[model samples]
Target: MTDNPAPAVVEPIPKWHEFMVPVLRVLSDGKPRTRRDSLTATLDEAGMTEEQRAVMLSSGQPKAENRIGWAMSDLTRAIAVAKPERGSFVITDLGKDLLQKNPYAITQEILRNIPAYRDYEPQRQNVSKADPVDIAVEDSELDPTEQIERGIQLLRADLATDLLKRLQERHPDFFEEAVVKLLLTMGYGGAENRGRRIGGSGDGGVDGVIDQDALGLDQIYIQAKRYAPDITVGREAFQSFVGALAGRGATRGVFITTSRFSAGAIEYAKSIPTRIILINGKQLTELMIRHGVGVQIAKTYTVAEIDEDFFE
Candidate 1:
């Protein structure tokens, strides 16, 4: 008998824009409802599973409620929903017409076509006159917060690629020194930052060492290899490093490389008595960014919201 395949995992929640039509439909009866009541009704109309509804955002709000809130914000900007009284909302005639026209899905592009929405949208200064369609396409897909997060992720990815390329171009000694600095920045060298690169002709397989305390009783050895991105560090190299660690009577070591490790190398490291930590090119660059070793902050953005308690 053939074994049954595992069921595919369903997405826990829909995108903010996906909640637009449901929000409108919930208020289509033209009866005024509190924001909380409208959002609860919208969630019911969305037909989300209990597991899906249990998802929460980092801000402690339910994921479904946050997306529904954004959907309502967009619908309000488009003048499709009206606030007839404080904290209560009712669908406008425009919303009814939209529900009739877009029976299946209502998207940001559809909302953008409304003149009222365009008027309400914040105007940008010095927007490129060339390729206007690109701007529209960028705005139509994701809501504001999602767009910001996506943009930041793409920027970091590009920055990581450039950092790896530059590191590969420098001298092998530079790369060795960089790994030592990274370890110090990560707080591995204690508060005094006792770490040094010792890669030379007389040096053993280890390239760097970090003292975890002032007395240097507790120490961690490091082996850094500056290889091309396509090169893979193999088991033989790790065996040599492990032998060197044994010679130094050390139980912990870190092996960092600009390339990747062979599967055998990884397995061998895990099987050994000594603790071995491996850092590849991707991980190295990410650590550099996170600990602000080689990269510096270029810009900072601050987002603020109305203080509800202040009004009270």
Candidate 2:
């Protein structure tokens, strides 16, 4: 038999308006639905299976639920939609009107029509806009290398924050795993084995431990936690971890958690001789994505810099 080549699967491009369209339709139909109901029903009508919908909702891809939530927030503010009760949403008259009128709906059209949304549209547009005059003036005012570096930094910061928000909402355990992986990736320790059952004894606050080097000359302690919303790592926990590190004679320790550190914890960590690195849920997810620990880059953009020598 002749070998058959595998067919290329083209991923569907997610559109903000497309996702919102079904919700609007449901609401316009005079059927009030909860967010869960709306999401499930819309996905069903769109011919998406449960597994497909699950992947689409939490695939860690761009315009996933986190981005969708951002779009939903904007749409809600613009009077395009209304949340009659917590977790329940319906289309406003404006949304229904726009839905019927715009056959080819774009985010720009939605923003332009909504007074509350117009402010955000221009800011988003300016982020990727290229104007020769503006570029020339900006180049003259700032060093090109510095400008690019700063841009990358700002993008990284934003990505970190967005990843954090999403992690908190879904796969919180992954966030904790992410911290351990990030530390391992950064060469603070060797390989990471999370949630390993270590015989009858619990590891206290410590979840995993690794050597500072391959030879296993020194060991670093780790405390991994999967935390929920508004959870904060307190000073007492930090002190206990420090004590554990001291007992082991490890100068370095990592506190990895899917939660924010208390102000007192931050101050206490700084004052201690035990070198403690704190990775909050946000930073943990960001570092994991950046370092390619648990994420794969689906797209790559090669941003070119202008060659000044060409003018010479």
Candidate 3:
């Protein structure tokens, strides 16, 4: 009889509440502690497993360590812990006073009751426990620079997805125009409108042509297929496209498709001597967003900070 396979290793995932008291204890000394030194010793003292200590979050930090950081943050908001010198911190009177009570538990309820933390309690309470990203995002807003950049990134990401969906719904001609506009905005075609749509029945897979310069002689061919999500352009399609390019004596081409290119098609393009840049639906939308092809700016915000050089 064959031996049974060993069971899968189950990594320890501790809830945030489990780390609260341990983090509080690490700062109970009332003396200032450097960021790195305290976190290193705190988790081990709390009896965290080696694997748990080593477990990384999506951001590549140890999960237990991340929770501990959040624990400190919550405590800091309540004035239980005070950050004195950049990453160094000390336990405040409020923190030591709390420890005098229920030294074992420093619950979220207790933290919010304090005046300093109460002001920000509503935003924290609004975050759903079901979504881990919610609180993390809320916490990331603590830094001025990170908050603004994070908001922009979230907006751009949503726009890219929405753009792709809208493109798939629009007319084929619209998609073609979008591809051309994106290239134009990227400075491929100059002020003379070097890109022209030539896609038709006898076009032999070539959809458009872009003049790298104002001159009409040198050309970069474009083959855009507004395919359904389920359709994947394969090697045979690439062979036909490359053949069409060769027929026109063109060595450079862009193959833009609403659907994906098959692995074989991508590999073939990589192996070929000719220059063929592939743009699938995802990348096409991303490029459009970057080049401002079809989207308009909705709102803009300007965040300002003190200019330290002005003080000098």
Off by over 4 Å in 3: 1-142, 308-312
TM, every model: 0.55, 0.48, 0.54
Whose lDDT is greatest here?
Answer: 1
Model 2: lDDT of residue 196: 25
lDDT of each: 0.83, 0.60, 0.74
lDDT of 2 by residue, 176-246 (tens): 45555666677665454322212124665566666666666777667776675347899998899898777
* Superior candidate under TM-score, 1 versus 3: 1
Over 179-294, each residue of candidate 1 has an lDDT whose tens digit, in order, gives 99999989898889999999999788889999998998999999999887658999999999999999999999999998789999999998999999999887888899899988
lDDT of 2 at 274: 83
Estimate the overall C-alpha local distance difference test score of candidate 3.
0.74
lDDT of 3 by residue, 1-312 (tens): 999999667567666756667766877777788878778767866888786787787768888887777667667656677666567878888788887886787676666557545433333234563342443446556577766665465456545544555676778777777787778788877777788877777877788888977666878898888876557999999999999999988999999987789999999999999999998876787788777788988877776889999998
